[model samples]
Structures are given as structure tokens and as C-alpha cells.
Target: MIHPRGIKSLFLLMLLFPGFASAQKDWQDFMKQFPDHLDISLLIQDETGEPLFQQHAGKRIPSASIIKIPILISLMEKVDEEHMHLDSLYTLQASDKVGGAGELQHLPEGSRITFRYLAEEMIRISDNTATNILIRTIEMDYIQHWLREYGYEDTQLNRIMMDFKAIEEGRQNYTSPQEINDILIKLWNGAWLNENSRAEIMHWLKGCADNSTIPSQLPAGTVVAHKTGTLDYVRGDAGIILGDKPLILSVFVEKFDSMEEAESAIGQIALKAFRDFGR
Candidate 1:
């Protein structure tokens, strides 16, 4: 005979997953309304681990700067281990500069910035230069270690952003919709941090100003802590929706005619999930 708790849990899973197809008809219907021009993948889950809804979740695609989420988590681990400090200052050099999404590239060489500034700018503005600073400080392999430990087998950060040489060498960053959502779940579950540091991570995510995707179509007052990634033909966002029945949403769009179309699709998907999940 099944244990009482196990039976109850099994019942909950049945209730959520078995009926998900029928219950998420609107989401399916919404997708039908869009043109057949994009590879759209979505995954949403309630506070529990139930698969609220998923489509093409296991498919891997370019992550753009969204890979920074894992990078951030790895950095936090180092912070907790006392190997890094929020107040520690990192000096900027000419080599650290990159050309996408940040004020750091324009800042003069010989500038000094702290971990707090770099991390915040990295998330808030999707700052590529700040990401390089973090990548150089902690190393790309260090972040990959965290991804493996966290069970994200298909997610990879093989090269830094806008790296043409790396691209020429066949290096790229990739992640699945399911894996991205899983990372958010780990963060939500407080996988490896104490209260203060976890809260700080959330704070930085909440500070993100590029709300072009998941948070775009949510209710005006809705609070979402998410990271967005954009490339010429790809757009992605992943994070949590907080306050009253929190939900996690990750949407990835690739091979689109225009960035605007992809961003609109993600916003619509996020709105559907927010409504379907009863948030």
C-alpha cells in the first residue's frame, strides 16, 4: 500500500498534469493565433514543482545573455564561501570592455568598480562588459560547475557575449526552456544560500529595466523579477512572479522575422501563464 503522504502527493500530480492539457487550452489557442514563423518555447510552474504547462521545453536554443542567471548563482556561492565579497573592488582595463548593453564599455580605463556595481549593472541593463568582469573574476568554468551541480546538463556558457572569434571557433551558449525554468525553481527553493544573499539576488533581478518580454504584459502592479536576453533573431526571459501564489515563467523565442514580434510573443505567453495559473 502506498504511504498516505505519497498517495496524496501522487493525487496532486495527477490533478495538475493529467488535466494540464485541457486546462491550458487557452494557452494552446493563443499560440494558434500567432503566425507559423518562430520557434516558441514556454515552461511555467506553480510554487510547487508541478509542470503547469510546457511546449518544446527540452529543445535547446541560444541563451543570449540569459546565461548570466547561472553566472550570478555561481558568484553568489563564491560569496557565501568567503572567496568573494560584495564590497571587493575590481579595476577596469581596456581589455574588459565589450560593445553590447552597458555603460561599462564607455567608462574610462583605470576605473574601479565593486562587485555590487558590476552585478547590479549586469542584471539590470544586461551589461555585457559587466558580465565579462564577472566572467574574468570567477572564470567561465566556475559557472559551468554550478550548472552541472544543479543538473542543467544541456545548458552551457561556452563563450562570452558578442565574441566573434569564439563564434568562428564554433563556441556558443545554449539553454532549454525547461532548464531555465529549473534554475529559477532552484533559486526559489533557496537551494544553496542563506536568507540575506538570496534576497540580494532577488533585489538585483527586480532592478532589471528591460521588461520587453515576460513582464511586459503582466498587470501594471504585478511584481516580477526576471532577466531578458536579446540577439538579432532571438529573445528570452526567465524569472519568478512574486506576491500571492508566486509563479515561475521562462519563454524563449528564436528565428523570428523581427525582434519586436518575438518580444510580443513572449509577453503574450507570460500573460497567459499568469492568468492560467490563477496568479
Candidate 2:
């Protein structure tokens, strides 16, 4: 039996020691269970954008489709600047189609697609053809400028998806878990876009088709506005967890034996974060 004053002291002691110790153990042990070749970058920031837990968060890795997040941001910024309108239509020719994740290639040639519709498919389904269409429609310099201005110095899109020539040239898109989370935090805080644009972007993100990663282990009906980028065995999922406490998480898994395993690992990480942060 302990006195009430002693109970209060015990609680403080737990907070000062066991809390940090447990979190550290959880992260380290989880990572150690997997081989080191599996390059994984994870970051969890509280609603205030303060770091709660980070592992290899700064390491630059393959951006995969996650690079589209910044691309989408720049597109939205262009819209806000009145340089482009979401409703503006662009004709997609046979030459514009790329082989990869999206369904756009199956569409009829000369299919007119609105910028907003392209952006929607770009995010919601990780559509490669739609992404390439936007990349072709939006200037490369414009996207790079926006990323630099946004402080995503390490994140850039160097080529359209499935650009084998660019691949031969060793030019590829790249981004990190840290950068994506920063952008997500900004989007969550409404830092960059106007109300209407932000609202629409969030709607598209929530409609994202991939749920095997961060959102998989979360409770059903949990609203996570996230996008998933996968390149072979590497996977990235960055999003805002819109639950009781509102958290931000970015998990990048690379060089895994299989995407299935990588996604399972990420789902576990997200579950731990949910347990820690969700009220």
C-alpha cells in the first residue's frame, strides 16, 4: 500500500523514466527484428508538428510515387496563383500514356481530361499515366521551384514515371519520409493552400485506394488522408491521422524482400504510433 502523495510521486517517476524507455525499446526492437538491409525511414510528429519519434527520417531514398505529393502541391499552388485552373482540359494522346499503376492508358486516345480529374486519379489510384500527363502539362522548373520554396531541398521529380530513358540516364525522382511528413503537416495545418483548395486535396487523399500500409492496422472508419508510393519492394506512406488527437506519420520501407512484407511492417509501425498518440 502507498500513500496518495507517494502515488503521485510514483506517477511522476514513471513519466520521467518508463515513458521514454518504453518508446525507445519499442522502436529499436521493432527495427532490430528485421534485417538491416531493409531501409526504413519512419517519422511521427504530434499535432503541433513537434517530433515524437523518428528513425532514419532524414535519409534520402527513392521517392517513388510519393514524389507526387509535392507535384500535387505545386499544381495546387499554381492553381492558387491563377497560373492554372483545375477545370482546364488537356487532351491525352497515345504518346502521353505511360505503362504503370494508373488506368489512364486504357482510355481512348485523345481523351480530354481536366487538370482536377487528372490530379484526382494521380493521388487516389497512384495513376502513373495521369501523373505523367500532369508532369507534361506542368512545367518541370515550376515544380522544382515550388519544392525548393517549400524547403523540400532533397525532394525532386527528375523524370516522369516509367521513363526508361531517364532511367538509363540515371535520373529519377526522390523524396524522404521527413519531407513528405513536413508537407503533410503543412497541409493539415492549412499552411499553404486556401480553404477551398485544401479541402478538395484532403478529399482526394482520403479517397486513396491503398490501405495496406499506415491505415491498415488502424480502426475501421479511421480517417487518414494518405498517399502510398511503391517502387517494387520499396514503399512510402505519408499522411495525416485524423483521429482523436490528430497525428502525422510517414513510413518509408525500402529494399525489402517483398512489398507485401514491407507493407506489413509499416502497418505494424503505424499501429504502434496509433496506440501511442491516439487518445
Candidate 3:
């Protein structure tokens, strides 16, 4: 049975589509194919912000690398506002390396990199080292204030990437499926960002190296600008799927014993959304 919290969103979907009942049944059955212990949160919207589907979308979860999307936005906002320049260079320090998805950690200390390079690598490779560099450069306080000012109260960057000490202290980055979808909506509509910044953001996202989640089961070469996140039992993917009927899909899965199972679910969900909504 679907969680009670999802009923409101399902009702909204039913109101928006004439054949939603049949689609709902299909999704219900599809969800049953996953292990019962697995938890999923999803939000699917059309390019115009119409809610196509939602399931526990408000449930905040460990964002893992998905937090980088907001960091990217925040950085771009600063760049556009003239508070920072993308061409500015930062030197890597021995203290900056973090043990996670990235090659920058292995680079020798004193390596200099541009803000643009760090931003791109942070998304393209899910580079934790690069992410930390950008986060430090942007300053945690300003990022937090920006999120709050922009109405992303539930989405937050509470700790830098790979910070075990902060995690032990009960601090971790987090975002909800709905919040992610909202962010993607802005990107889709070209809101806030200047032309060059928007182009650069989409370019980096389209180049995301990890296609093992939402893009795995998509049609070969389907254009999806997305981000994937992983942390122990938690897994997620959120981005724009450009095609006949463009879509913004954000999914988070947790409490699963197998990473492959969680990721496969993510892929299957995206594929189903593509086919179902494309019709």
C-alpha cells in the first residue's frame, strides 16, 4: 500500500489528467515489484511545473552529492551578481582533500584550479574534493541564507562533503524530491541565471559521468541533464529529461540492502515516466 502522505499528490495528479486512474494503478503495481523494505520518494513534473506524479515527495532525506546542484546554483548566482568571478583561481591545499567521488583528492597540494573548473568537476564527476572547494569559496552562511531567502527551507547544505565528524554530530546535507523538482523547474525556465551561466550549468549537468541511475534504462542517447546521489542506504537522481514531452523528475530511495536494487528502481522509474508521460 502507498503511504498515506502520498494521497494528496495522487489526488492532484488525478485532477490534472483524464486517464490518471489507470496510470495510478500501473504505478502502484510497478512499485510493488520493489522490496517492501525499500523506501522511495518521487516527484515528476512537466516543463511548465504541472505535477504529473508524486509520492512522499516532501520527505527530506540525506542529499549526498545531490546537494551540489544547489551549490552550483548558489555559485552561479554569486557570479552573476558580480560578487565572485568564475575565472578566479584557487590553490588546492593538503587539508582540502576529501575521500569520495573525485580525482582532485589525489592531486598534489598546491595545484591551482579555476572556480569554473571546480564547479564543473563537482557535478560532472561528483567530485567531493571539488565540491568542498566551492562550498568553502562560497561560504556556508551565504549559501544557507540564499536557500532560505529563495524558499528552500527544507533544502540545506549542513556539512561539507565527506565530513565524517559532522555526520557523527548528526549533521548532513539534505533535500526533498519536491524541493529538487522546484530547483529543476527554475533551470528549465531559465530563471535567475544569466544566459552564459545557464548554458554553462546545463553543459556541466549534461556531462554528468555517472549514468548508472536514472539514465541507465533510458533510451540510448536520451538527453538527460541530471545528478545522482549515494550515501550508504540512500540513493537519488534528479534532473531534466528533454524530449517529446520534457519532464523534471527527482527520486530518492533509501533503506535498501542493495545499491544495485535501489539504482535499478531509479532507472525503472525514470523509464516508466518517460513512456507514460510521452504518450
Give lDDT tens digits, candidate 1, residues 187-210.
Answer: 888988877788999999998999
State the weakest 10-residue window (summed lDDT) of model 1: 1-10
lDDT tens digits, residue span 50-155, model 3: 6777788888889999999999999999999999998898999999998979999999999988998999899999999999988998999989998898889678
Give each model's clash number. Answer: 0, 0, 0
- In angstroms, give how far residue 27 of model 2 lies from its true place: 2.6
Spell out the clash pairs found in candidate 2.
none
RMSD of 2: 6.8
Q: Candidate 2: global Cα-lDDT?
A: 0.83
Q: Rate the local accuracy (lDDT) of all candidates.
A: 0.83, 0.83, 0.88
TM-score of each: 0.92, 0.90, 0.94
In model 2, which regions exceed 4 Å deviation?
Answer: 1-18
lDDT of 2 by residue, 1-279 (tens): 222333354456457878865776677777788777887888887776666677877778788888888888888888998999999989889998888888999999989889999999999899999998888778888888888886786688899899889977989888776777878888878899998889989999999998999999888889998888888757889888888988899888888888888998888888878888766
